[model samples]
Target: MTVQDKLKQVAESLGVPFVFEDWTLANVEIDRTPLPAVVYVLPASGELDFKNGNIRDNQNGMLAFLDKVELNGNGQDNDSVVDRMKSLAMRFIVKLNETGYFELLGGVMKYQVAYNKLNAVTSGIVFDVTLKEVTGICERNL
Candidate 1:
């Protein structure tokens, strides 16, 4: 499976919406009514460097953004959105740690507050992820 596919799988396993390939946000309909979503974006194209004979290292930089709309106009705190974002990000990290197939170099979860198209307050988290692909070595006997 591809790296994108694996990441999406991890997100789905945690019961969170996952988007990777084409139109990462197109799956949802964002009309006047706001919705919560977890979107994965590939900010830079992945780099494939030769590691050894017939082996290559694929490095991909990704960002996972958690979007939550504040429907209530009571000046609600962003605690809920922050919690959800942290939970999902933690799960992703755990999954990656368990699997030797990927490496989590380092990342930071940045809290953001912005206005949506409907002028609604949106609070979310953006996780900057640096991922490295795992290489497999095969032994052949003649």
Candidate 2:
């Protein structure tokens, strides 16, 4: 199965949709070494460098989705779940940036939302958001 399909599978099993409707990017550096500096290193600074950025689509409600996700060390209190989500969501952002798969690609997106509901014994959650275009110049994989 494709990567998107795998993500969907994970979400379905968890009773959520694999929706990355919004967008963001960060952690950029030039990599003359031919690999991202974050995961690898270069002898010289400019020889291999990198930088990070984001598209900021935020339609499926970036804030809300982030607010709902949970984290390991974060609080599990009634008021802390949102913070946990934000923290966990940031990890994806960091990973995307470190791998050089994300960067600003200017575009317009009003709102983008995706959701799955389970009304039987649990409540389905939804997120509202917009879209943002992102681009990349894959260093390791093209």
Candidate 3:
């Protein structure tokens, strides 16, 4: 399976709705979702590490977008959204670690909490992931 396929599979295992490269507010309407409840695996910039003549590794930057929401009927709760975001992030990390196809490369993973300006109830967590594709057999024969 390709990297994208592995990502989608991971999201499926987590029971989180998965979207491909196209994930915009308009696209959210397709799901009739008032909140950002879907996980978007977007392909970002990447670099190809040249190995032997025919072998190379692809290191890619993928963005995982999750919901960061916490709103009791009363009002905005303190650190509730942040707590939820961390939980989701941890879950994602665990899932990625479990997958043999995608390897988490060493890099500073950036995270940001964003509020939906259009709708206050809709908040989101953006996670930047550095993944290395290492699922293949390398054969050398003279």
Candidate 4:
């Protein structure tokens, strides 16, 4: 399967309310989407490497987990909300690592939590991923 297909599978396994691809299109509807969602964007173009007449594809992508932030009456973010998002992000990372389907090209497996504007105050984690594919596979052809 393709990287996008693998990512979609991972997203579905998380059981989020929504799973979207192509952030450009999904961003327009994020405000309307229900909370606790996952979105990923993978560029169509990738770097190609040739070795001994074999080609390798390196693709870069991003995945995010979004959720509405709970706010206190004082108009401040609730600590629990932030903690929940972090916990969820950790779970996602664990799942990603467990898949064993993606071969990371480079970079460490780290995510950042950021504030986002949605229907309400939102917080989420953005994860950077790189997938490597070597040509002349055996499984599918076989």
Candidate 5:
């Protein structure tokens, strides 16, 4: 399965909506999406290395937890929302690790919290990922 497919599976296991790279709320329909959603984006370019009869695919991506926020209206507290997102992010990382499909690079994980103009808050983690697969170089060359 592909990286996006694996992420969708993780999102399904966590019982949250999964959005691709485009999670912008500019569209009115997007505003109606349920809160506490998972957004996955591959924001950086990737590299492919062919060595030792194997292909190494490395890329950088981000996983974001998004929720609707209320300023004056009665809603969940901002701190609580952020805390919940953090917890969810941790769980997500655990699940991703269990998959063993991606190798996470060390010292590149960054947790960020930001608010958008649509009164939505997001907590995200950025990391580098690598996927290696053995290629039958001899057979192909023959």
Candidate 6:
């Protein structure tokens, strides 16, 4: 499939919204959500990926939030906590791979996983991707 098609597939798989003109060009808008959410894009011919997304630390409100994952610690459930988070991350990455964009010519030229948030206001919702992932399969360039 063409590059655009590939990208579209990725968006659809992840339940993310996207618009494409001429059935080739694509426009994807990711909402800055809470709970470790993310929207990453990897261009072709690039070594890194761009994570123009958001990751709201749900556990930030409380301390020892991840203590649960620490099996050694009494009453600590770090395992479950970390597991759930890892699961979410896994799902996100899996969906992106299924997207047609990764299958584009040279496919996923670059990629990265970043962190950021959305400035939601009465006027409208604007997502500000603060942290951009410069490593991973999504790199600078081919």
How high is each candidate's TM-score? Answer: 0.66, 0.29, 0.65, 0.67, 0.70, 0.27
lDDT, candidate 3, 38-73, per-residue tens: 454455566565455433346344454445345542
Q: Mind giving the per-residue lDDT tens digits that candidate 5 earns over 37-88?
A: 7776654666666677555555456667766665553334666667787787
- lDDT at residue 88 of model 1 (Cα atoms): 62
**How does each model score on lDDT?**
0.54, 0.27, 0.55, 0.64, 0.60, 0.29
lDDT per residue (tens digit) for residues 6-121 in model 2: 33343344443344221212112111111101111111111122335322221112322322222233233423544444343344334433443324212442322212111111
Q: Clash pairs of candidate 5?
A: none
Q: Give me the displacement of residue 43 in model 3, in angstroms.
A: 2.6
**Runs of candidate 3 exceeding 4 Å displacement:** 23-38, 50-59, 68-79, 105-108, 117-121, 136-142
Stretches > 4 Å off in candidate 5: 23-32, 73-76, 104-108, 117-142
- Model 4 poorest ten-residue lDDT run: 133-142
Output the number of the lDDT-best candidate.
4
**Separate clash counts for every candidate:** 0, 32, 0, 0, 0, 38
Angstrom error of the Cα, residue 68, model 4: value is 1.2
Off by over 4 Å in 1: 21-37, 65-67, 72-75, 106-122, 136-142
Looking at candidate 5, what is the lDDT of residue 105? Answer: 30
Question: By lDDT, highest first, what's the ranking?
Answer: 4, 5, 3, 1, 6, 2
Compared with the true structure, model 5 gives a TM-score of 0.70
Error (Å) of candidate 5 at residue 27 is 6.9
User: Residue 111 lDDT in model 3?
Assistant: 74
Error of 1 at 101 (Å): 1.9
List candidate 2 segments past 4 Å from native: 1-76, 104-142
Considering every candidate listed, which one attains the maximal TM-score?
5
